[model samples]
Target: MRTSGRRIVFLVGLQGVAWLLPAGTIIQQEEREPGTSKVKAQATISIDAGKLRMEQEKPGEGKSVMIFDQSKQVVWMIEPAKNSYMELTAAQVQQMGGQMQQAMKQMEAELANMPPEQRKMVEQMMKQRMPAPQAEKEVTVREKGQGEKVGPYTCIHYEVLTSGKLTREVWTAPMDQTHLGGAEFKTFQALGEFFGKLSGQAPKGTWELSGMNQMQGFPVRVLEYEGPRATSEWMLVKAEQRSLDASLFTLPAGLKKSSMEGMSRE
Candidate 1:
């Protein structure tokens, strides 16, 4: 399975806009077992970004393309396919960029129109909702504890309270590779309400793992996020360490350059 560079770009955009919650924290644990590094698997991802949706298909052969959609219907497609490039006219790229700038300006105007007290409340609530870091505590090996299954994996459960008034309980499962799954991580309901008030949504909230997984003999890491209104899954399907073709990332020479230098000044 090859990774999609476009997905990485989208995830970076999402993280840039996501407001940090006071109760948010990341936990990772890995198991070093022999032959684990030898196993590899492929994965498909479905991402929903409010107005736009994208589907990624990763297989053993050929390059991957991301199908774009709007309201459940296909609208456009972008692919960093092998040998062949997805051609985009320079005018189209500039038009898309201009529309994005306009949409951002509109969203900023909406936020700016919010009442002063409401804005303060939103900020305070976000601060309180962010995940708190775990204290200087060591994991003690316990004789036994409760066990549960999340999805197809079994997880060990643990609970903690942060300095803020938020509590969290997490269930983690160890996979063969460094990839760890937080099958069951619960956060405060108030956090959801707080985000809702601020016009933010995290359907699954921010809980997932990032690390290496092999796709079609290539070592790649999958970074995924699921929230109430949006879900994004990304994989570094191909990396330099795996002998990926350098030409795969280059733009096509056949693309014509645009002559619109004076248009923006007007």
Candidate 2:
């Protein structure tokens, strides 16, 4: 089934904000289309010490949980409806990267033996089918101004530019004012660095893990765009600094562990 463009933008907004979330806080965020008050998607994030859990729900995409354990350097993606979970570790990610490199080497060897004309044609087809590597763009962040109210907090407005074009507009409040712990904020920074290695291992229909290597403070509101057109808006609906249950960071008992090999086959 094909996914509509609107739904795709909604998912991107949800996941992008997840990367911006601070630890030791429970946050509820809603994503909406640019000109309307109607919510298109929403997510809840819980962060404690070095553990983080996010629950997200979409219209047709059901709910899923993502847990990142900094102590173990592992990430678990749970599908409640399927009664199963997928685990990713740093070592496993390294092994997969090695395998991909070997596969590329094999393909290159096969292409070398082909006729010049055939090789050119096959190369063109490969370029069309495979996504080319994206060059990293220079990202610059500038404070737009100060004292903007978002939800219950007054925030500082900032703009993020990529290659000199506006990419994201963000409003943030100081972590101290939000009453969230600063230790977890540092832990989340480490989490971002860790998951930066496992680039594409998250569930297909769910969120992708990304790092918040740039910009700081608790994000109160975020606006994402493509070129000049705004795509989606995310607002912090609720933020609480309270003790969360330990079980919220753990997988359910008796749940089957899904293997990466098995997942690839599907």
Candidate 3:
């Protein structure tokens, strides 16, 4: 229960901001996380001044979409497989996150009052039930040098070290060159600031890209490896500026719109 609650808080905060830009479509190549598979997935991220959407491409799979509307301060997770969309407001998300944190604090208080052995058993049971966490990764990023083409443009290279071991190389080109600048960039910044407060922790890449405001450019390619094995890579395949139809920012017809608050109340 605690884990799921934490996940909700994290997801609500992250989804509200992470993927965004101007009126354009960005095609990205996403490989499964390390140890999963060699197969890759294509994702289309579309953004306009007022909204953002991400759709993963897969054969024989029903359409799934995550849409965020900045003006409304809401997010919609659409599942065509189920013919439904789940929505959450910024206020509701923050309130739910606060509830989760308070519940955890109360749990800690109860744990403190319990006998040592009982507390240990409870923790052990929790560990056994939950999935193992990913390797503890402390990411340190620095601009190192230059690199070859990333997508359509030449880029500068940056290295990512996880727990002091170099594990990733990133290539970046100018943000404007990606066709996402001015108003859209400002929208992302606003979302970042808004969510950073609710999440209590800044997103990982957010910290790594801190000074990019003055430096320019965003990561266009990221190659991640584990030792000699190539774990994963996500690269920007295409980007262009255009006016996205407003309908694309909303749920499709015949699908029901639902809210987290209503479900929780029920």
Structural RMSD, model 3: 15.3
1-266: candidate 1 lDDT, tens digit per residue? 13677888889888876544111112221211222432222323222221211223333443333222222322223333422223333345446556655765675576688998987776577446643212222222221234455444444544322332213234444432213122211122222222222222222222221111111111122222232211222223211112223232233354433333411110
Which is better, 1 or 3, measured by TM-score? 3
lDDT of 2 by residue, 34-95 (tens): 76788877788888888888887777777778788889988887778778888988787677
Candidate with the greatest TM-score versus the true structure? 2
Error of 1 at 29 (Å): 20
Candidate ordering by TM-score (highest first): 2, 3, 1
Error of 2 at 174 (Å): 1.0
Decide which is better by lDDT, 2 or 3. 2
Looking at model 1, residue 112 earns an lDDT score of 82
Worst ten in a row by lDDT for model 2: 203-212
Which scores higher on TM-score, 1 or 2? Answer: 2
Tell me the tens digit of each residue's lDDT in model 3 across 50-132.
Answer: 56777765555645676777888876777666677787677876776677568657877888998999999977885465312
TM-score of each: 0.22, 0.72, 0.64
Model 3 CA lDDT for position 79: 68
In lDDT terms, how accurate is model 1? 0.31
Give the Cα-based TM-score of candidate 2 against the true structure. 0.72
